[model samples]
Target chain A: MKNTAIEVLAVKNLKKSFILHNQNSIELPVFDNISFSLKEGECLVLAGPSGTGKSTLLRSIYGNYLTHFGEINIYHNQSWINLVEATPHSILNVRRQTLGYVSQFLRVIPRISTLDLVAEPLLEQGETEVHSINRAKDILQKLAIPETLWDLPPATFSGGEQQRVNIAITFVKEFPILLLDEPTASLDQKNKQAVIDLIINARDKGTAIIGIFHDEYVRNAVGTSIFDIEEAKHAA
Target chain B: MTMSLQNPLLKVENLSHYYGDQIGCENINFDIYNGEVLGVVGESGSGKTTLLKLISGLLCPNAGSVAFDTRIEGLRDIYKMSEPERRLLMRTDWGIVYQNPKDGLRMNVSAGANIGERLMAIGNRNYANIRSDSSDWLEKVEMDLERMDHFPETFSGGMLQRLQIARNLITKPRLVFMDEPTSGLDVSVQARLLDLVRGLVSKLGIACVIVSHDLGVMRLLSHRLMVMKSGKVVEQGLTDQVLDDPQDPYTQLLVSSILPV
Candidate 1:
């Protein structure tokens, strides 16, 4: 296994902004001439006010936006890949293979069962359905979601159950990077700490997490080192 | 008017709402009073929102009764109130602040238009009066008057929440129900919005029912707190008593889950 403390992702002098109507651009510069690096197994959190471009910066590094003029380096296989030249499709492939994303709102397929939803990443990674289903059931049981609800469409599940399914999806594949957006916003205290413990457990397994959290309880529950997006946006 | 020391504005007698054949809450009983803030805290699916739905007359109780005497009416139970009576109360006596500000707001309409729509729903049609009233509440919620014409998409999430507040409180409803008001806001923004809601509820003497999972928020804002687990109200008491020294095991577990910052 690779050394867990080594740098995994690095960005240098990144700049990105949006345009408005009549040639007047809103120009939301999130990381104006900013440089940062993340080490393997370390989680970086971005906390800020709404519309401060915290989500935008995550999208930019994931190649969802064009970094106006900067370079990003992704470490892999004993070499650093200059992400500046990586195509969006390639970025997506890398993300799919190595990154996991969790949003504030868990997006389970409307009529799909919990087992199927959790098995998606595994199936996408070329695992057989039989193998994925077994893995899914195990995780669901471990998470304490009722076994009877496993085959039922997650639409009928409670808010906490749906979030548990979303959490299970993050663990399906051996991904290195996990991205979560307020994974516990609507959860009561019981589920909030459970989700936090789950994330910390995942980080121990060598996953680099990038989560957007608004709840102080969730933020303090996981990372001791936090990247305040409000300061980041203001400094820019 | 002197209220009886034990008089409750709204009383739930073993009240329960069932989603289809399933029980939302079992043998759930509680009493809410006028001008009081009652906080309901539970997991996402613990039926906190469902309880609010029942009290607002949005949903019918399947197993129990919601008995209340309102300032607006001739009806004893709002569930049995006539359509016109329901309309009247909705128009002037109650407001509901939804969790997703976008879901509660009309994205296409300007902020002013959103507030006007609330008035229009209640049959307020004089455009001049509506505009004046909408702007009045806009300032009541502490929102900028200049941005009244901007669509909800133009406003930030915190601003959108404020807009929803303006829309709901414009008519000065006697009571309001908030479904996770600070679910998706930043810490500072959440604190500000909570303060705004607290101040408004106090100034207007409007009773409030706020549902959230944050114990600290409930402790900071609610006079009383109800703890729900699975599908039951395991404990209910003064917010300080329940949160600071929870008697129920589930309440204690929940309190332990919260990390004080």
Candidate 2:
């Protein structure tokens, strides 16, 4: 049982910085040193004050910044990839096909229908639009998005409605590693709890989740026996 | 019923709105005192948006009246006010930022155009004045003035929302409406944005009506909350009261649903 349960994604001594024009010759270290690992069917919540670079770490993991220094080891399909050595194209491939990412914002394709929005993840992996559309509808129904909302651009939906669409896309992909950024922030209490329940449910189904969450209740809900990122610092 | 004794900047009485025989919301009555954040929380299609529209003068009420501290064009109630009067009154005291940053903004337009568009509609056409004014507001919203010439595409989601906020608050309108302002942001970004919004709202003493579904978001930013269900407000009170120990079944279900566990 122990041998079968392996990490889905692991980072070693991840470091990132930026140059500020006002501060000469000195780089502004957003994340001084950060490292964590997420196992299959498990989740780790990153909690911190604003501007502490919590979002930056997620972006770095997703290769949103190209200049970051880090060694991220992702285990996919029985093969371990040293993400530090992986090429940009390969990393993009991983992101596109294997990584389920929930960006901070609901980044929908403008003017696209809601059904198409949820189906984009499936399409990213070359799934046929007809099959993807059918699957997207099922996921949307489970997520509690109304059927009438399927054809309208998400711009017309309430803030909560738009958030549900963002979430529906996350589960449409058959990925092991899920990266979510405040997935429940727009939802009301009922929907937020439902989402948390879904994540725990998804975890049990073998999806490793790395989420930057501010909800203290969600952190405690996930329980202990975790790889706490706050304790790790620059030791690769 | 013994009414709330305290004087209110904005007052609602038996307020109701409908969409083609469908009750958008009904029997809504509340008094919003000056300098407080009144939050409205509910599920999708619970009529919170319609309530905001009615209260903000964006849509006229079908059944009741909204009385403002300062009347427009000698009209006593918003429902009875004329379009030109609403425009003149809104210019002086109403500001709104939508949930979708794109809706709150003009996406293809430059940052300057986005901020100045509203100002121009209200008849501020001096170019230098618009630039200087919008630039200072951008700084207030924690945006870099150097990127002031860029379009919304070049900006991140958080920055775009911030720009929308700057444009709304630049006028220092007395009443501000925010519909899920932090809905599409990361926690870190949400924290910063909420802080900026709360700080600015408090500093200017602007009375605000924020419609959000996030209990945490509402609790963090609002003084009071009005929990809605179906098409009516189930409960309205201080945030601590409504969220901690709700008596109404719908409100109770809502409070319980936020377990985060």
Candidate 3:
């Protein structure tokens, strides 16, 4: 058992519900009164069937989706900030250095080259052009991106290529906490292996990881603890 | 863990070099067999990088010889070969993976061209065949084949590193020199890249000389270990033995300093 004293993230009484206007104005409760704690170097895998709001729970912690009620507290530096009540500026600051999210899509400015897109975070962090570009190039190479398309917009890239580029940008920084949503869905065997290795490395470095992995192999390889949303629903 | 000892693919004997009066490395000796991985680890200012440069032909050693076993020439001193001969050897029989992909890749050309250039250098001319081979290598390094035409200037760091690996390994080089191949990325990215490297090295059965300050990397990939301090070897043995039970105090500190996960 992990000590809650050193917990990086703690959720208490987390609840979410939405009005189903199309279905007689009924209110659909996703999950209620859920509490858990995640420590450093621990991964909590949200395992359940589709439509279980697995992604919703992850986004709520990231402050993208607002919950009906509950406390999503994330420990930053020393004190804990309640995501459900924190201001936008605090959320932004926490996201910059402490939290990272790798969704299933690659969102970038149109016409921007792949290199600039991936180098944006480092460049924003005040890294020099030479150093940032060099670092960006290093990550791209590890993800198996060919050089010729680096200057072109990723809009024209295949699904797997774009996903790899997305992963590259998110992983380029070393955030203390990460949320992964099917990070390797479009990857092949070799690429999947690469992603798995990256996840393991991050965990070993004491990053708290929370993710939803539909691939059983990947889930087994990366998950240290399971957070079954379906079971949570039943328990509630 | 053990590689074929039959014909030591590369032999470095009494190798010594200097940058002005300062020592680079002195009297370094080792033999890398076919499909062997030799790890060199030390703190900053150690001669590990310099020794790698010397062995990979980037820097000429002031003394001793680097002999390689070639199919046609048998065991011949690499320094004695003509410039063209040495260049050919580099293209066909040897590969070097730089710590920074920027140092090893051509940023102007398309990723496919970067990989295909090596094949063209070695007399391959069919455009279709070259393109096909480049695509295959891209896949091998986990890159999408569709981006073969993209220039390296726009690639992310991890993507560029993978492309560089694919570019260097496409020619099926028998021996590879890697300089901190997994440094400067987040731990997760580094781990993935290291796994890719380990898989490729073993699949291709290529001998390698890897240099890194991270003892974890050395333990994960190296078959034999060489510890250096003050430009001299202090302890050398199997990777596990040297890491688990160090004879030198420097090595002991290094092993103990690994942050617990």
| Residue A107 displacement in candidate 3 (angstroms) | 37
TM-score of each: 0.51, 0.51, 0.53
Compared with the true structure, the alpha-carbon lDDT of candidate 3 equals 0.84
| TM-score of model 3 vs. true structure | 0.53
Leading candidate by lDDT: 3
> Lowest lDDT 10-mer window, candidate 1 chain B?
B1-10
lDDT of 3 at B205: 80
The candidate, 2 or 3, that scores higher on TM-score is: 3
Q: Candidate 1: misplaced stretches above 4 Å?
A: A1-236, B1-6, B72-75
- Deviation of model 2 at B208, angstroms: 0.6
Tens digit per residue, CA lDDT, model 2, A1-236:
13376777888777777643233535567765566777777777776666767776776676554334768788755688776566533464566556777875675434557987688667645577799999999888878888988998796788887887888878777678887878887788778877777777777777778887777777676533344344443333
Question: How well does candidate 2 score on lDDT at residue A228?
Answer: 39
Q: Write one digit per residue (lDDT tens) for candidate 3, span B76-146.
A: 88888888888899999999989899999999999999999899999999999999999999999888888
TM-score of 1: 0.51
> Looking at the true structure's interface, with contacts defined as alpha carbon pairs within 8 Å between chains A and B, what fraction does model 2 recover?
0.00
